[model samples]
Target: MTLLDQPTGPSASVWPPDAHGPRRDPAPLLPDPEPFRMLGTPAADKLDPELLRDLYRRLVLGRRYNQQATTLTKQGRLAVYPASTGQEACQVAAAAVLRETDWLFPSYRDTLAVVSRGVRPVAALTLLRGNAHHGWDPKAHRTAPLCTPLATQAPHAVGLAHAARLRGDDVVALTMVGDGGTSEGDFHEALNFAGVLNAPVVFLVQNNGYAISVPLSKQSAAPTLAHKAVGYGISGRLVDGNDAAAVHSVLTEAVEHARSGRGPVLVEAVTYRLEAHTNADDATRYRTSDEVVAWRQRDPLAVLERHLREHDLIDDAGVAAAAEAAEELAAEMRAEFHSEPELDPMSLFEHVYAEPTPQLREQADLLAAELAAEADPR
Candidate 1:
């Protein structure tokens, strides 16, 4: 029996008005008691060998990309980078399950996910490099620009999904956000809209233990970030983000659920970022090295590699091939960043509006005159 079925006394009235309206059983909507895992468990043995090997290859590539991007930041080639050094499983699995027609809405830290979805690595980092508003054409790939603002992309995903539903298009929009972004109004609003509209949307919350330096405990009192779905009336899932097999399985299920018109789903992936929030932040100030060391034992790449090796799904040759491919990608990234990007000063104003406003026109003219003077020098 539910809590509504039990009353204290005659003083207890019909508490929730269940008799007056329809009610949903919240049990089916709640997340698993613990994060769903497959790696390090007997279940890992049954995963497709081919699939596991593919995931391993992508994880290796993603890790190398993270390292190379971080190196660029140190060398002053890239302006800033939010390295997904430890979250390769989440990114690769997410990309693996997405269809070409499906839309991806990613946050700043999800540049790796974008690249995995066919956006060129150099193009994906354009925003981080301060080179362009969007490095690649978002429309061509059905991926939105990597949003830097917290939780803002959630509503965009909801709107697009709802519109697709109305148009009878088979599209599922997946928006990935941090655990901290759960507190934002845009996140809540998107959840509410998705619930009411039954939009084909999935929310992937990569709970990497912190919102910047603030730990998850200090951020919210929810039993788990996945529980955030209950209040919004969508299904919730919890997954071991470090387990490539687990993340891929859970996301695949959730995306299919949404695409099938069951409404949106919320999935919280429990993981950690081995690196600081970014190159600019000091993670050590709030977190201890011991804690980091403990988490490193469950590193996504390492966990997947161990499972693959133990099952004989991948051998020395496979490992060597993956590493060599990663090195080539890293080398290409280094070559790409070697020269300065050719930026047009006036081009910034081009996309602001169809017809430039008077103020915008004035500003563009001023910038143009400045450029002319710089080119001529009297």
Candidate 2:
């Protein structure tokens, strides 16, 4: 039974709201009525010119990376790719706000963020390529595996943050999840635990409008994803996911809040997934062309570029330089992915356990024996 359903006694009268309900003070947790925008605003003038340039370059490369990765999928180099074509701002800013020493726990859609976090581009796609369990070493890069299971990474981020606090480590764990993931039990548990433990972690929800074939309208009826944070006693922030400057500014604040021992914070970046959920899904089946076109007008890269140009921070030469660099990166990825990778079937059993069980060892031996026989006979 829920707490609200419990029988109320004389002592219950002393409780706040007389046990009617949680009656949480939500004023402090309310997100802005509209998603915060900065690219075209006067506030954009105050931002550092170099930082704006950096964001623009990253956005350019990030867009190119998404295109190349999607192309790789079509070419059979990558098993599948969930492109962040229109959501480059969220990806880039998520990384830009983080320190190298900080940990990033990313969902499968966050490969761009992983790459921006200093992981080699090729290594970040290892899992997506189906060549390895994870693309990079978690301990080495301070990035967890790209989680395919929805909302599971939330709890992992909370656990790591809580542990770091216990050990007196000066670290913050920023976990990224999609809006749909907010409905999962793990998401609730993680938020609740983080709030109670005062863990230094930031939860970023990229509200990309749809969860696969499902639209946000079919999802939870929460006013905004950020509002969910208030229930957990954590701060909530909302920002225009298409505005890189706004995303970076908001995330920077949230990260600083967590790092300062103020407890966990939740940020919802309002973005739209312009592409299909993956190369395998047909977006045309669910969305209209006009809708896609509308979002394209506010494209993250274009918005930032326009802002920079208006401020005289970048000109045609700068744009060309950025594009050229992006092309080079894309070319490098294409060449690297075309090369065949060495594989060992036996290696799969190696990392599954520290000490393999007798049953596992027997299975491994059986596979090995079968391989050896086939090698000699065929």
Candidate 3:
């Protein structure tokens, strides 16, 4: 069977209330109308103005950086770029709630999330420049390397959470994946193990409706990805991924839940990929113009900007300053890239072993001698 053909159990029938007799009206394709799940008794009042503004800034920076990276790729400075243009809310909100002691496992598109956790901008550039396996030290920040293989990080996150529990630490591991990753065997295995072990972890699924060119409907038969947690007996929720405040609220709750030893939570943030899957893919061939237009109307940055303006937290001047600052930061980043050191050939062999083995040492010496001879030209 194909990926989409995976069994999702029985399907529920759709019928309007007050429908009498067998009326043959076609069911409209209605968007799910779940109420935005806010946290606390007085949800809106629970979050302070400062926290809200900070979230907005982080998300805005993420967007600006993504745009700059795309431009860099076009100019042939970066080898390849994966734009997370529309997924800022998911990255920022989730990263914001994570404690410094907690661990973060991110995918390649989650540079913003890593940055939020105190990883320097220059460190992130190391990976894009192909000079480092990962940008930051895992032990220092408790963050794993950005995994490019789909859903592979899920199991690693589970292992981390397990280790934390064994050590009697209160640390929780949070990892994110695209909607398409849920179909991977690693995703299910990780969830199952977390459930059985009662591990403190959060599985964040950014359901942007497509895995590359494939639509969500063609990827899975499930009505909603959140329901995947039902079999594992873990708490699950689906939130408006485009709503920054909503995303923050849900993640805060998830973090608290895991910290309190309530086991794990599966959060499905329903979002959309505004740009092509990457710089390489042509989304126009698979998705319709009308669909893309509709999603753009709900762009996360635009939605949050309107919210901030209406609430009197930010004004035109604040928006202008933020934009200007973002551009300046991007400019500094590009300059830094130009001055980055050349990759050391021997450095590759240096990190492979704690103490170099006899065979490896001999190979490194041989390579170094060849390099030295070439440079000397004697």
Candidate 4:
């Protein structure tokens, strides 16, 4: 039989019966063999000097924000704070890449990203403040509330992107998740839907060494988190998470690709969390001080600052200006957290539904009556 007419497995089609089945070469979707770098490389010269300076300023501010937020938790201001201490590059670049019209769906540890997107510093921590409602208006800023559930925001982002496409709107929804979140079913579903629907969305996974106390080795065996995109027939990109310029470049490309109706892109940023997972986590138990110190040697802020100074993009005055700005923000956060918010217990029933259910209405009435009685005793 001719090569094309060969039969196998009792089938007359071809030697390989599945030869006609649809297949796609995954080479284009695979991540780079090495994490993309920019800071210490010649590529750094290609970035805009002004943009580099701005990124430096933001990184400084983000570091201060993480420090102050963690202090708030110690002072009993916030119920819990998930500090992105060492991952500022990922946070800042994730927001910097998007346009004002785009949406940012952030995880609990991504307060810096939300704040970078123009949300008030204190308001970004509202959910962690134990408030019943989100601190910032999602509709007003095109930012969703800080999601505490792992990977849940991924699906929400995909849904929003798909809906926008159906409405003939050109909007990109970028969502941030940690390495641990990639293991969730929601992550898988989101990638699947985004690929099938060709939705405009970008998934940024900050592979910051550990998912809580679990190291990356335990969370995923995939060569890299970005490689997971290939399974969904999407593009995958890997970057030095601590390199602000590289993260911004990669994410900007992914966002633009999605904006051009090319579907989704998954980017994995290799970073390290310098702090415990949260105020509640004890990282010492699972990790060694040497590991933390080694990562600190490659701190994102320092890395960017080095590049800027080397390129003469920033000077002593510029560094001082950035520090002053960060101090001002920290002061603002401290003042805001020290003051108590005026919360109405009854307002909890307001946003639960368009129309309150009978049970909810009854509870609201009961609470109102109790407050009235307490205000003026009979």
Best TM-score among the predictions, by candidate number: 1
Candidate 4 residues lying further than 4 Å off, grouped into runs, are 1-21, 357-378
Error of 3 at 162 (Å): 1.3
lDDT of 1 at 258: 98
Per-residue lDDT tens digits of candidate 3, residues 1-378? 776766563352344447744433222212234725433225655667788778778777889888888887787677667778888999988888888889999987777788778777667656665776666788897788888889999999999999889999989999999998999999999999988898999999999989988888888887788878866767777888888888888888888888898888888998888888878888989999999899998888888787778778899888888888888878876886667577778886866689999999999999999999999988
Q: Is candidate 2 or candidate 3 better by lDDT?
A: 2
Ranking according to lDDT, highest score first: 1, 4, 2, 3
For each candidate, the alpha-carbon lDDT, in order, equals 0.92, 0.91, 0.81, 0.92
Off by over 4 Å in 2: 1-24, 357-359
Question: Worst 10-residue stretch by lDDT in candidate 3?
Answer: 23-32
* Model 4: per-residue Cα lDDT over 1-378, one tens digit each: 677666654444333537656456899999998999988888877889898999999999999999999999999999999899989999999999898889999999999999998899889998899876678888888899888999999999999989998998889999999999998999999999999899999999999988888889998889999999999999999999999999999999999999999879999999999999989998999999999999999999999898888778899999999999999999999998888898887878877789889999899999999999999998
lDDT of 1 by residue, 1-378 (tens): 798678775476555566656567899999999999998788877788898899999999999999999999999988899998899899988888999999999999998999999988889999899887878887899999989989999999999989988998999999999998998999999999999899999999999999998899999999999998999999999999999999999999999999998889999999999999999999989999999999999999999899888877888999999999999999999999998977898888876789999999999999999999999998
lDDT of 3 at 278: 74
Pitting candidate 1 against candidate 3, the one with the higher TM-score is 1
Model 2 accuracy (lDDT, Cα): 0.91
What ranges in model 3 sit over 4 Å off? Answer: 1-47, 350-378
**Number of the top-ranking candidate, with lDDT as the measure:** 1
Global CA lDDT computed for model 3? 0.81
RMSD of 2: 3.4
Clashes of each: 0, 0, 0, 0
**Cα TM-score of candidate 2:** 0.92
For TM-score, candidate 1 versus 4, the one ahead is 1
